[model samples]
Target: MVEAQAPLKHGGWITFPFFIATMAGLTLAAGGWNNNVIVYLIEEFNIKNIEAAQIANIINGCVNLFPVVAAIFADSFLGSFGVIVISSSLSLLGITLLTLTAMLDPLKPPSCETGSSFCQNPSKPQLFVLYTSLALASLGAAGTRFTLATMGADQFNNSTHQGIFFNWHFFTFYAATLVSVVGIIYVESNVSWGLGFGLCVLANLVGLVVFVLGKRYYRLLKPQGSPYTALARVVVAAFRKRKELQSSNSQDYYDETQKGQRNIVGTTPSNKFKFLNRAALVTEGDTNLDGTIKRPWNLCTLQQVEDLKALIKISPLWSTGILLCTPIAIQISLIVLQALAMDRHLGSHFQIPAGSMIVFVMITTSIALAIIDRFLIPMWQKLFGRSPTPLQRIGLGHILTVSSMAISALVESRRLDSARSHKLYGNSAVPMSALWLVPQLVLVGAAEAFHFPGQVSLYYQEFPKSLKSTAAAMVAVFIGIAFYLGTAVVDLFRKTTGWLPNGINDGRMDNVYWVLTVIGIVNFGYYLICACLYKYQNVEKAELNDTNSG
Candidate 1:
């Protein structure tokens, strides 16, 4: 009798469709509620406009911030797939609760009359439920967002395939977000809030189901021991051996491969961060006879030492991202306010929803990303004989971001002029077209098309293999911090300058944009200095050398 053949393993291209569908559904679900939250709080919950904006910013920050913790959990304990399932379930529950709140009368306060002076605040229980729902949803969304990227990238082995996957991932993500901003926000504003949130609930369930269905076809990676521990060991060992003399001899360092563990070969310790090399020095009693570390915290491998050094080298570049993103974060919240104050009419029949204005940024970013990936990169490669590096892409983004702020300042000045000319400056909508806000939004979107992916790619390439998920999450963490910082900046302006009062119409909104413009230019100078001093840790040195030569 012939031997039975084992079943073929699943994964690779077989999982792409499932991952795309899941991503689209999740994006739609998250965006549907988040995009309209400020309006929801203002109109339904009877919250003040500025208060609602502040709440929305905080929520956005939480949604981005919690992902770093989720990434840690995935890397340290449960793998990405496990974390995703739990997180998606949490999201579904949150959306369900949110939808119920919309449908039920007791969950919200009585509807406020249009332009009413005294609106009833929500009861404490109602507020508690609302906050709880938001917390769960934000945490859930954050957990799945970037972890999914790491998971999808793991399904493929080829770098080119991984690159293509990321492009499609972002494309699907933005497209679904566009749908939520336009379609769901329109439903919530024009139709019924209940129906709109119900759609989000449905989307969440669908995304979760789709992801579960693809489990068998997924290349599920198990969690390696936490890389943070190794990093901590390096720091501890270095500090402990601070007084010890450094050695240039290779044999003086601990090599774990003698005991059958993998090791970094053919790379010498660099001169930079010379003190860290002490961590790997093989002093007496640092290692056992079997080549295992006697005390892991007292001695680390050369690879661990090098890994810490890489992170240290990239930290300055990492810090620049916070400043880089703060302006964009502030602009995102403020643009909605701007739209609310402008005439949002298209032609004679239809009026645009103020919350839906962000779709312009999403749409532009999607288109620009496609053009850059398909046309610009190839052309640059042909002309320069080397692909554009992340630093170059990020530098272009800085330029574009600065330009966008200047355009924003100019446009706000024009809108202020329109407001003043019509004598409707105090808390009332201006006759100026909302289309005036389009140029700045488009420019910012183009900047994102360059910098966002560049940052992700940069982190993925430079980070150690064990911290792959964490690397993907670094961008989210940056944006999260930026959002919080942006909130602080806005509060500062409100307290100090009158640039951003409760109603932006009566304030010097243009001045705020100009301030951001100056900040962007200064930040760009700082970024350039960091970029110049930085050497590639994981990338080919030849790329930069060749660029310089050309």
Candidate 2:
């Protein structure tokens, strides 16, 4: 029985690398949009730092949240194909608006265009249009990101497949980020910023078309998901489950197919459940204990509640971890830099591209994640009894962040010195070697590679099976917090410390490193306390995870 079902369930062209590749492309596109747009928004909006970061935080958090919503829809009503198509199409529309914003004559800011001092205040109408466009893009991002990864993982069935799902899951994940590194560093930083955004929107369009082309042969998992019910159902299932099992010995086992799903009922947000059979990714539809009549909801079933609790708690660790997002927020803050005391000239090209530091940060950080996991951890495990946990990796990641900030402080202090010596020019000019940015960017990327994977893995594993999409959504939530906090801190700094004897404010692009570096130090300490409390799972527990997902 095992042999017969195994090959068919696990291996096929659906597990083909190409299918995974296409899915990975969507992930890259979503992340690329999240990443590249920040730099431009900050520049265009003349926004405060915290206000700027709110953009990234809001977009990423909502993107993460919508997945749970989409997952429910997919499992219950919309099939995977339907959701993927809609999400991808929405992304295309959102990106088009962004493209229009970018392609404006002389590429104007949200409030005012280049070479114009006409209006001091852009109305709510303009802001509303921009927000509307961004909001739609965010919606598309949230749904597509959730489904694409889940779908990619679904491509392999663990019971009979030779495809190493665990490996491929992370492999596709890392591969997608590799593309983000390119988008951040090369596309956004190296190319015309508008062109970078244009590509992001275009990628979504192409992805939708291609996904349609391949739809026929794909094995749409019979969506055996749970309904989008409220938390009360989880409680009822536990109570009834104990009653049914009370008559049996502790060793007694019940096949999931033997019982019907626990009955659930609800309205809008507040819902409830009655005694019903639990559900699974795929399950036997029989409702009676004797396996008589068969019926099941095509929604995510609560298969493993005990395991899910452990997973959901890990989200706060990542709550503030996507530090690369800060740079995204900074693009808008650049206008502040220009207003404060920066010199935009290259200082002979060796000067750092202060505005573009995040690009290098994301690239190197992703590379570091690959190196630490594949190479460094193996070597360390051989030498020591332990391989690094996600918490450990996060700690290591923060060290780089802290260091990046410290370096920024030193750089800013030096710039201040140069200005005092009359060697430094104005706020819109560059003073130091662009190479000075390498360490900060590289450190940021290293931090990312180390923290994000395990953090994401922890979130998915910790949340109850039915809530994978929702818990994964939490990873983006902290980033939102981080974004808001970062922006707020910057605003405060600019208003308070923005001024120096030379008329420089802390918002100067060069001086902003000082801000990031210091904030990184503080963020690192907080991450330390959080990491200590974090509980994680081992590789052995993954299979049983299926047994308990409800």
Candidate 3:
């Protein structure tokens, strides 16, 4: 008789602490450089304010965008553990280089005297080194960010445990980031850039080492082949069979094998995207006697067709997310510029770090996430007799986002009034307090608390099992796109209007916020339309089946 496989003792709660510690370290390391990069470029490299902002947006976009590629690599070839190890090493190297650049005067441009008419920009070699370091660091961060979440979730068997794991994952992520923004950024701004970057390098090394130490505890999964290939096949087959009529008979379609048996649950393809069902319509020569697919590109399984359908169904909802993030992206990049022009002093002792101002968003999101997960969700379930759906959560986020933009517009209007009254227009610093920017940041954070996790949950649950990692990184894809789009928007405004002039005090930033607010409102309406039309592909069925099974 064959021996039964032994259960893993090292996974579950045993591995949780290690994962948390590693994530904390990596978070601190990545956040340190990422948050303060614009400041570094402006102060050290003597780049223009708007130019630095654009570069920062592009860097943020790359950091978020590259995760999709990393996720695909992990899912299709390397698996999460291998990707994390490789990525962590890259991050360490990048941070070390950054530290060296800060410490060595030759690596940076000559420091410009305060109020100097001329400033020396970094040389070609310096720019090349800086870009290379950023590329390595971004690539490293991309690999670890969401893959670690997937790996941690894999340790749990059920959705409840997985949900709890995600909660802790995000909480730890935001908390660590908050610390970096507050502590490391403070050090960078006040003490020394080299010291701050040195800390990041140390954190990256520690995180990698801690992760390595926990290898025995990890439930290492071998990668299956690329899900994208299968998805692509479905689309190709559907197009090839476009002339063929789809059949109503279950026997006419190929049903995928599940647990050594044919899938009984999805015998009939979903009707939402009826056209894609043609891919699964089995012709006489399409299958072997054993029901194995003969010409894979010409015919696909019902599950494959359904997977494509699910993606198609969710595409409209996903598209809405891009617009939702674009305004937020624009706001985030510009806010730093706003902080630069405003009075950042809290008391006689300390002035707030410009990059650290983003901590308000992170802090608010973290707190809101905890409250929503622990208290709000329970209360919502109690009152409604069910948990709030991801769609509902995302819808609420849309509302908050619009509200935040409006509040931002109002705040900018007030700040402008103060600047004009004080005759500080075209001046470097306005007398208006930087704290006025907090409310909008907090509001945006609250919106993110609602939508970011909601998007992840929605995609994770709805996407094909093979594409889980891809689903997790889908939010990153749109956020990346939004950042790029935001850059274009900023560029457009710079060329076309005076709304985004280098000096915020001289420009009509309030108008830009108003424009974003208008865009948000329109996008929210589109989102509502999409959400209303969308039928939960797996959630309702999974819940109902669970109830029935119980």
List TM-scores for all candidates, in order: 0.92, 0.68, 0.91
lDDT of 1 by residue, 464-513 (tens): 76566578678888899999999898889889998877666778989989
Pairs clashing within candidate 3: none
By TM-score: ranked, best first: 1, 3, 2
Please rank every candidate by lDDT, starting with the best. 3, 1, 2
Show where candidate 3 strays beyond 4 Å.
1-10, 113-116, 158-161, 259-266, 378-385, 425-427, 541-550
TM-score, model 1 to reference? 0.92
By TM-score, the better pick of 2 and 3 is 3
Q: Judging by lDDT against the true structure, name the best candidate.
A: 3
lDDT (0 to 1) per candidate? 0.85, 0.54, 0.85
Quote the positional error of residue 73 for candidate 1 in Å.
1.1
Q: Model 2 Cα displacement at 540 (Å)?
A: 4.4
Cα lDDT tens digits, model 3, 150-239, are 888888778899889887898799789988999999999999999999999999999999999998877777777668878899989999
Number of clashing residue pairs, candidate 3: 0
lDDT of 3 at 431: 84
